[model samples]
Target: MPNLLRKSFNVVNRVRHTASVAGLSALRVAKGERPDAVMLRETFEQLGTTYIKIGQFIASTPSLFPRDYVIAFQGCLDQTTPLPYSYIEQVLKEELLTEGQSLEDLFSKIDKEPLASASIAQVHAATLPDGREVVLKVQKPDVEVIMQTDLGVLHGVTKLMEKLMPQMRFASISPIIDEIRIRMMAETDFIAEASNIRDFQQFLQMTGNTKVVAPEVVEELTTKRVLTMSRLHGISMVDEVAMRQYCDDPAQVMADTLNTWFASLMFCNSFHADLHAGNLMLLKDGRIGFIDFGIVGKLAPESWQACMGMMQALQDNDYVTMASCMVDMGMTHERDKVDQAQLAGDLAKMITRIMAEDKTYTSGKPFNSKEQADELNKMMLEIVEVGKRHGIHFPRDFALLTKQMLYFDRFMRTLAPDMDMFSDARVSLLGSDFKQ
Candidate 1:
């Protein structure tokens, strides 16, 4: 009976929360602001944590969303207000304490303040009983329950919208929400994230990679809601000034980072999906640190080969191979309808434009990051459109691969402007292929 009452209360609260945000959205629409991608993204941000995560999913999965919506949601921030330490402390005790154990028995010291706070969890600095520096990732109170209730509401609303608005039927909103729910639930499970970290650690050991590292999971203190990991000390890769104090060459760090990541695509159990500035650091020992294993991606063997071939072809300007590889990597209900010759010609034009832009980067003019990002996004959208014309549709993994490559490209431009990623002798794009 209590469980039933609690669930009913949760559903009512979720409806109230969503209605408040929807009212603001309706007001915006009434103000002559056409409901577009930008407005949709703004509405999602105001809807709170679940919608922010959904917005990020839309941004990263270009294969599933329109070009404009994908581009607009790229700026969706995952930050949220931090919960009070007392609340966090209650959760820690509920999850961590045993019959005979106490708070002091497990930790030497734990800071009351958070090191980093996100929508799902917040990280706090602490030391183990043995004096090992670690960070505790604590899931917010009732996060899982809230996510479940909100997703149920989102799914029902999507179905109703599709029925009322015929044009919305083609968007497949329900399935997208289902996928988001699965990913969000996984994000809340610290055990799964810990497994991802361990898999990465094993991959590093097998590859004999000493230049990169991930945080070690402290298994004893880890649970579904709480993950304890050995703390990593480093300077941000983008903080060139602080980085110079630890390492003389910032470009070398970028090279190591790129090489390790590329190799992981072929060798690791799963490659890190989200490698933003916050997740990457240049450690005091001059090695790259990859933190936060909450998100990862896997590619089938055939897809991996085709993706590598496509990247290699881009460097060589072999449009035929690039076109062929695209067909191999993509999905289509009617493969027989594709015209390879036309696809090749269209790909050649796009590659030629990119090559021309590459020359500008080396022409001694100042590199405008915003302009480069805008141009790249345009080209990516164009590529998708071109593929669609030929009855080929890239999968979500392809979008994930391309997005990470975009991040690497931006980093390389800032750190090693003269180097070409694919053509550079130092970068090992094919992990085992280049092994000695």
Candidate 2:
């Protein structure tokens, strides 16, 4: 089996190349271990930062990864031992020097301990010289090289696997790896993230989204490897108790948050792409805090327009319009060749299969992660199969959108247990004038 570890090189990345080949061979499960997916999850956890980041991406991207892998990688947190404060200081000092300043010139104090630690970076609480509290996200040393080396090898293996297993050709593996590579590269560039923060804040204001807030970027104190922004006081939305303490109506809070995100998908230049529960929080001041704007998603105008119509069609269970919208969003080489009725039947069958698989034996209780992933993976596979059969090329941005919607579904399942996200009046999936 040519796993995601194919070639070796004579360059500096040789060690990573060797490890890729070695790591796959070492994945054989020992006695008492759960399963292959569990072993792979642990293997990624042990393989250092880039692999952990890869696992996180796998966990979040249901459209790309398999159900078991998705369920397994959910445990891949960015959490790690905090690198020394001096290392953090060193990065801050170096990045600031380019702007003719030092760490001390901007910050009054930086805490010795980090608020959180991840494979790529760690965040520390600090106070500006003007006494404003902020947090600095400093990237780990040699992260870009590690990511590059690992991703290069992985991409090769994916191409190899595509040739080895003809059945796997149903989904574009190389494109998925390329997508992940683009996202990882963007995340390492904090200068881009700072710009994203500024853009998101502006989008919030322009959309009259008073409840959701993105921290203001501090340009003087930010850099390509480090981000400095206002520190928000809040608790994660996953923290039910703390959320309840801050938000009187948690349901309304979630609704508002969803609406804001929904608006961004259509109106903003880019939407928050990686909104795992931890990235969003409920602030003490009764506002929603959106942190870490590293991985934002964007779509072409035609895609969003088709998406809006598709949502309305889905609401009405109008498979004909839904099929037409999907085909419109995708690349159709020949408009005359598209069989709208056939597409509609395929989509209707997919929906029916999904409805059959979605079983909540106990009312008001959602299925577990594995169950949900299984159902979702089945539906996604069906959709892809339909696309392949019809000679349609669905856009990657649409896949990203699907992943975000899945994340929101998990959110509503946890926070607003009984809330039907699409049908909920508060969530305008389309504009107010949108009709089925």
Candidate 3:
């Protein structure tokens, strides 16, 4: 009976949310706005959580969505207004309370004001009874219910649209809806995120790497909805001036980051997938701190071996080997359809043209200019296009990998202007002997 009541409440809440979204969109239309991708993205951001995840999905998935929509949803904000403290306290009480223990029994201090707020969770700076500084990551009230309900609503809508409108079939809306459900559900599971952090920490320890770290999860204080982690003090990696206070050379930080990340591709259970500026930091202790393990990517062993091969090939300017490794990394419905030689020739031409047009690489300078960045993006996209032409479709993990590599490229341009990413002696591609 309780479960049924909860389900009913969730449906009612979803209905109200749908009505609100419709009303807001209608008002915008009445103001003489056409229903374009930008407007839709705005609507998604305003809707929060599930919709924002969908928008991000669109942004990350160039192979699945159109160019204009993908471009518009780039860097879609995950931020939202902070929920009230009363609600947060209530969740803590419910999730952490025991037979005789109270809030005071657990924490010495939990700040009412949030340090940061996002669509799904709010972070508060806190102190343990033993005087340890930590952060409380509390999920918004009913966020799980809301996300599940919204996904159901979106799934149904997508199915209906696909049946009624043939033109919508190309977007593969239903599959996207399914993928969003999996990702959003995982995000809501703080326990899983905590486990990811632990796994990464283990990876670091095993590799004898002390230059990089992730926040330590306070297991006793953590739950599926709320995560408690040791607080880290640092400056964002991109802020080179602020970083100089702790580290002499910020470029070394980037090198440590690159090496650690590349090693994780073959050695760790999963690699950090969403490592944007916000998630990476140069700690006051002169270490690179990787935080927010909410999203991770696990490549198959065979796929990773191929990825290593591809990287080595790139360094050697061996486009033929790179093309073959790409075939191994990506999936295809029709294996016989792929023409390896043709794909190799296309890749060779693409890289040559890009290098010639950009001149950044040959000029021995940082790829800082917008034109250089665009050329890099074009090269990645053209690689994908070439793969598609040969009937190969890169997996979601490949997209995540590519996106992080691009982010690292930006970081390199800022911190290590003269460094060559492909041949940098400090960066490790896990070497030829690395095996999972």
Residues 247-357, model 2: lDDT tens digits: 777888888888788778766779888787879989999999999888788877678778777767865779999888877875566756889899999888878766765
**lDDT of model 2 at position 94:** 78
lDDT of model 2 at position 27: 54
The digit string of per-residue lDDT tens for model 3 on 353-408 reads 87877667688755566567766666666666667767787676776777688778
TM-scores of the candidates are 0.92, 0.82, 0.90
Tens-digit lDDT string for candidate 1 (253-285): 888888888878877888888898889999888
Backbone clash total for model 1 is 0
Show where candidate 3 strays beyond 4 Å: 1-7, 23-34, 165-171, 308-319, 345-366, 431-436
User: How much does candidate 3 score in TM-score?
Assistant: 0.90
Instruction: Give candidate 1 misplaced runs (Cα > 4 Å).
Output: 1-4, 164-168, 315-317, 348-370, 433-436
Ten consecutive residues with minimal summed lDDT in candidate 3?
Answer: 427-436
Candidate 1 local distance difference test against the native: 0.83
Better of 2 and 3 by lDDT: 3
